[model samples]
Target: MSASSIPGRLRRMNKTQKLSVAGISAVAAAALSLSLVPGNADAETEPQAISGAPVIFASAAGASQAKTIQSSVIEQHSTAEQLIKASDSAKAKAVSKEKAKKAKAKAHAKEKAKAKKAASKRGKQGASRSESRTPVFSNNLDGWIKESLSIMKAKGIPGTYDGLHRNIIRESSGNPKAINDWDVNAVNGVPSKGLLQIIKPTFDAYHVGGTPHDQYDPVANITASANYAADKYGSIDNVNSAY
Candidate 1:
């Protein structure tokens, strides 16, 4: 079936018969080329369409990775929040502890101040008691005599101003420093000293409780002499001797 002989064969046939011959020749040419052409071997071997499972698996893996990343971020944020809360709690505890310490210190200081004030008050009360018991005015001779008289009165010793003055004039001429150095008392190593001219041993043996210990002191000498006179002669006014 060459293409050059097909036109010659159609020229010998009638109109209707030529149409049938041309149709059959067209069919025969198509059939001859079908056997001579190569088949689609590579296309038949290759897959026609893709499956849905691989695309679905890829989408799931992407979603899981995104979820993991989001969870990591959320965990980190939660940890940070926990740390902040813990820090704040520690700070609050520390502040409370400091305030408590300050309050305790304040209470301790107040207690100490109260104790000091109470001690001071007790000392003042003691001083008041002492002043009421012994009402001494001045440190002079007259003041000392008056103060000693108060003590003597409390002890029930009897004496008068006239008797004490009369004896002082006769003994020392009112000189508080008068001494009998050439007398028998001086020879016996017990000198007569002060206003009343009393010996050292007699003055000491009859020393008044609230008077000065020195025999040369005027009030001390007068007080000791009066006390001795009260015990022996019963009163200072009855003493007419060198005693």
Candidate 2:
């Protein structure tokens, strides 16, 4: 081959080599572009630790709100519990007060019944004592007069038994049933009757308490009449004018 031909062939070869190098460079550049674009897209689209700031702030805010709600709920529950406790305490006190009131009422009823029973027993005993003493003064006028004289002597009255007996015998004729029919001073239409011819007013004034009858109780009538005569006239002799 001539030198010129050799140079041309060499030039063609160099040209071909350069063209291949350029094509390879272009393909590598396109591959690198594709890879870099995908990486950048992934970095933008995928979740990143730094990009989650808003979500983290939102979560923290929600947690704080939840804590506030929880605290409020706890406070409300505690208040409700306190109210329940107070209600229970008040109910217990009311129950205790009612029980005490019932007990007091029961005790008062029992005491009242006891007092009534005691009063009834005392009344019965007094009646029995009066009944037992009735026979001693039942039917004897002279003995009743003597008892009157004894009682007067015990009371320190200045009178002899004989003088008192004589005055009563003259006034009543020794009859406990003696009555006065001719007296002009009859009161309330009831005639003066019984021992000592005592008028109704005088008999009422001299009647003894708890006697069976005002005039029929010989000892009581005689003793009361004697005491009245002594007090009003200073002695039985002073009433002899009326007798």
- lDDT of candidate model 1 versus the reference: 0.80
Alpha-carbon lDDT, every model: 0.80, 0.68
Summarize candidate 2's per-residue lDDT along 168-208 as a digit string, tens digits: 67777777777766667553565656566666667677655
Cα lDDT, model 1, residue 213: 96
Q: Give the per-residue lDDT of model 1 (tens digit) for 4-121.
A: 9989987888997876666666655655555566774333342234322222224788989999999999999999999999999999999999999999999999999999999999
lDDT of 1 at 33: 55
Best by TM-score: 1
Global local distance difference test of model 2: 0.68
TM-score of every candidate relative to the true structure: 0.44, 0.42
